[model samples]
Target: AGVSQEFDLSQCVREPIHLLGGVQSYGALVAARRGDAVVDTVSRNAAGVLGRAARDLLGRPVTELIGQEQWDRARESAEAVDVDVDAGADPAATDSGAVARQDGPASSGVLPMTLEGVDGPRLFDVTVHRTGDLLVLEFEPRAEGGPFVFQNFYPRVRRALQKLQGASDVTECCAAAVREIRALTGYDRVVAYRFDGRDGPGQVIAEDRSEGREPWLDLWFPATDIPPQARRLYARNWIRVIGDVDDRTAGLVPERRADTGEPLDLSASVLRTVSGYHLEYLRNIGVASSMSVSLLHEGELWGLIACHGDEPRRLSPEVRAACEFFGIALSLQLAAVAGREEADELARSRRSLASVLARLTSGASDDWMRPGSGLVELLDADGAVLLRGTETVEAGAPLPEALPGLLANLARRGAVGEVWSSDRLPEVLGLEPEEAEAQGVPAGLLLLPFNRDGDLLAWWRHERPAPREWAADPSRPVRTGPGGERLTPRGSAAVYRATVRGRSAAWSPAQRVVAAELWREVSGLLTRQVVALEARNT
Candidate 1:
């Protein structure tokens, strides 16, 4: 793995510049300071040219080399003055003829300097700019080849692949991917944002944050934030790379086509400008630059891998290509892993249900059918009741007289019971005729009835979801003052969305499918468990 290291550029401005299509080692060096202090004097090729021998230049004040003549000239100018130098020349030779670039007015001061290297010669163009208590020196190199374009990310990519292979579970795999992306890109924060819509909103379900940062771990935003239209557009566009969120928008170049009148295909156009809405979102999130890759599962939108940077960053074409490849591989692995886990759970549930049923089909009495509680346990339900409506008998005298009728009606309809207060249920037990209509209790309570050889051996009843106020204002009401100053709790829809309905949970397609499948499986399992238990009793 490649580790990123930062050095104090207070020394100098040095960077590697290589040719695009050619092989060449080119670098630049510059020296600068603040208030007569020798802050930075370094070169990228220092080791190659000066090496340890280059130490001679350190701690030397700029006024020394110029003597009186050039010093006066520099003190008057207060601006950068490029001077040609030959390292081979004698120090005492006036022919050494160096021009001093001053950053102040005459008589103010001058930074006198010379550059020497062990190598035959190196050409540098330096400019000096002064800020409050700080001097900046920029070095521009004149070289045969262009500056170096960083490439060869194979090592980082290889390590990421290895980690992916070693991941034990889905969360770990995603976390590994996020970590690798962040590490590979040198981004401030990289997150694996899975799209979850359960509560009418899309949100981040999982994230692995970098150290020393606030967590966007489980944060959710409204679907309107990334509208369906926007998502569709993003899918068509493939990906987006924002260089600087605060930067001015560049003009969108009208793409030319072979036929003059033919409209350009924005789908494949990388130059299509980003929308203002998206830019605002990025700014709100504190991301200066970002790269988002769409994750697809089963040919549908799965989620995205969002790489965020605290500072503006631009990825080279090669780096972008590498990221795409890595993202695709990760998405495939994630989907496959999730599928396998789901299959395993289903298989386990089926096995448990089969065992429970084996005992019931033997004509076992209700007491022997007790172990069928295993069915409820496997189903993850609060409780399970086997109601043989045709043969049900009330054992407790205090029980409602109409209890059997209510249970029988519920059995007629297929419903999975959820939690609900007694008040929410209709008075199907016929406590009061008028009250039953008003309460609208058991139109038919949720029931899970399984058949045993054409006989209704037992049925399961589940409560309904508890009623809760969707949203409540948090502010306290206050009376108006003399100047009409007042405060009051105005109900907020946003709060309701976040708290009551749990928008994300309510809108999740994946969760819904999972719930439906679980219900169907439990129904079949209950039949088997009850029959098996009855057989054991016999």
Candidate 2:
């Protein structure tokens, strides 16, 4: 019996396979037989340039496809030779200087040749070599004018989307998006901006800057920077791609036949260009090009995805399309997060109200008043003195010596449910004058209203540490030796100004959205807690 044969994929191909090879460099597979046929020819970007599927090249013949000129050159070359084929040149129109002379061996280095594909006759770099019995011709794709021939978008895009999906919150989502954008385009800075309120109070909430370079980190800009008109336009149009910021903004000449007579909304999209003001703004910040993706929720502009590069940049059309799709996915996540925050705020408010009611009915106890009480801690303040009838509370150092008689005079006048500080003795008490002692009041009276039974009720006060300007700026520079000294005010701009002067602020719409969401959630919680407590008591 004949030995059984098994198909071995590696054995079938002349060249070793590299399945996990990085696509950063260009490569091709070429196989062809002498005279009769070309066995197989394949390249990475077959569909993009050749306009044919690589699978079609399998088992194909050379004479049946490539023109006479390429076949003739392949036959003559004794060893591998690089041949330049220009499809743009007329085949019949040969140059008399070279082809006209019928140069010896056709100048082995770069013989002119042409190829024929399904789309029609094409051109390529054909390397011819003699393999004893059958002549082999290797074909490499010719570079084209569009996107760089070597870019492998599939894996890059997949990785980007995977990263975006892993983000948990809006901040992380925007941050992830910025990081991906930087990786995709090699830009220097990326930012996220969101509207603060419906009235256009937006700000930057996140930024991803190049390492070791001083980026405008944690800086804030006024809403006027994006103007009402810009905000309204962004709300309507979900995204805008600015190919070249410094490029002229003239509309595509003759108008887009598909969009003719529509009075194009320039703000919506300037296609291939950007507005002068926007360009100048980007330039001021040292960015030469930018692309922004609008994040929207409930028909409102939630924020923006900004990609900024130091030099003029033009992203591949495919990349732009991919980014747009990714932006839409991000918008959905933003909406979901916003909805969750709203629900959380409502729940927090209800809880706070319940707590307030419980405290007001039985009177607030020492347990709640002990934390962060400012100077009130020194007075050994009791619960009644902290929560007594009052809209707010204030406390500071002990009162002056004459204040005891003054407080007595005011209390005798029936100043209902009010507390006042005093340091003087009251003679009407019928005791020898000593300190105007009142509950561990700490050399001062802990004022609280006496209930109907003249028992201590509630008091209110708030005191905090003295403000300091030494560490104010988040970007502030510090000089340290044996004794450290602050170099500037604690301001992001001041810190930036000290380092890099007059640079445009680097912020964006996505950051604002994430921050707005955060601020809204925090403020909503505080409001709910306070309102809930008030609601219960009232």
Candidate 3:
């Protein structure tokens, strides 16, 4: 029943995964109004998990199920989490991985409670959070146990933090992270997947896996693998788990809420049932169970600590929380490493810039276009150009003769005296494919017009021949499910090799700053030249 027609990848992005009206059967959910504490919604399996009738659950105070004191503590814990998030508190500030006695709360918003049931009492670790106007409490029964302790995972995570913080570079940091995650989770494989940029393709930079497993250590995955909607959820939630892809989901009672006529928004629910397409995708990849711990930086979904198990595996809520804590610490360490690298790069750039400036200042003439000015190598561009009035002078590789006309059109669009750039220069200039190729057009352009009259310094980058390796053919990203019920993006294991064209390496923020600084110097030189010429004429 696989799709025979061209696949529409947009369907994946449009799926409202968070509004799915079910929860994983391993846990049961109960929701009550935050203002009134009146029970309004519960998963159909809530009665089975709580050992009470579903009818008896609704229209009662939430305190009836959870004792009044635990209820207050849950609310207080949720509010504390909210405050921490709002203030952007350091992830290390709260150690959710701390071990506790079986009778005590494992972490904030997670506590053990024995609820009265039809037959004696059942102990569960209750996870509490708020979604919209509702207070949601999800209950997962504890494994038959003696004294439960988070000792195993807590120490591993603590060790992981030490390694992450001590690492001097991103490569070392990521390698240490994956190694610790694999050791802590016992997954067949663990990898750190880093996105190229916002919503861009990702690559598995580092991996720790079983000897028998195929290496995905450096494989690249298209952004479509995790669609935009999924990215939004990952940015909001720190952890997501799928115990068994084959298990049927427990339906939510009434499905949609009576007030909004919409399914429960489980954006923050740890046990929320996931997209069927995602489940099928995991199965295709030979993963029976999986977990993703979001790696965030400055509130953005930067990457993920992804784990895969060959057989169905379920982790206790405590284990998952500990993993989440490790992810947070790793993110902070990543930021520190990146900041240090950027600072070093800036230091080097300043040294080179000062050298270039000294040469320009010592010159007998004001013209910085001279060979020793280093303008050609300043931005690592393939070529550089100086354009004034109607004249154009170039160095290094040749630029399109029509480039001057293109710049005039750009100025007409009001880019005068402003910095402008594009990695896909031909496309931005509105040239057709044939036209661009025939003209041997550069793929990137950066312009700094010193004044509104359109006199400018320009840099161009030639089309870089880059061959990419995608997990699958990006054009065939989806196919109808076996039963033609859903669209899935996974099926083939063969890597797709493609040569990407019409684009150049992107300019970084530091390069842009350098461009601006250069512009100020250029403007001063031009002003002095004009004043000297006028003085001689007078």
Which candidate comes out best when scored by lDDT?
3
Estimate the TM-score of every prediction: 0.47, 0.40, 0.87
User: What C-alpha lDDT, on a 0 to 100 scale, does residue 215 get in candidate 2?
Assistant: 52
Q: Against the true structure, candidate 2 has what lDDT?
A: 0.44
Q: Write the per-residue lDDT of candidate 1 for residues 1-538, one digit (tens) a residue.
A: 1123322321111111010011011222223344564424433333443232224444555444223453334433334432211121222422111111223321111232334445544443333434223333323243333222234677777789888878767778878888887777778877666664311334454565557766665555443344443444343323556667775532211212223332222222222335554565567556788888766665455677887888887654345546766876786788878777767777676676666555544553453236443544444433334455355422212223344455555445433432111222344354443454444332222233443221222222223332222212222122234544222221123233223210111112232233344445445665677798899999
Output the TM-score of candidate 1. Answer: 0.47
Clashes of 1: 56
Candidate 2: misplaced stretches above 4 Å?
A: 1-155, 199-201, 251-263, 266-273, 354-538
The list of candidate 1 runs beyond 4 A from truth reads 1-151, 198-212, 233-238, 247-265, 364-373, 383-538
| Residue 26, model 1, lDDT | 27
State which candidate has the highest TM-score: 3
- Residue 145 lDDT, candidate 1, scale 0-100: 38
Where is model 2 poorest over a 10-residue stretch in terms of lDDT? 16-25
Comparing 1 and 3 by lDDT, which wins? 3
Q: Per-residue lDDT tens digits of candidate 2, residues 1-538?
A: 1123322322212211111111111223333555566543343334444454555654576455565666766676644442211211222523221111111211122233455556776655543444323343434354355332335666887788788778777888888887887777676777787665553334456777777545544454444345444554455444555555565432221122122242211221213233344555566556777778777776666778777777766555455555665677778877776667666655654444344334333533332233343223323332223223342223333334343334334444333343333332232333233332332122223343343323222221222112212112323222323333222222243332212111112222332232223323333444466699999999
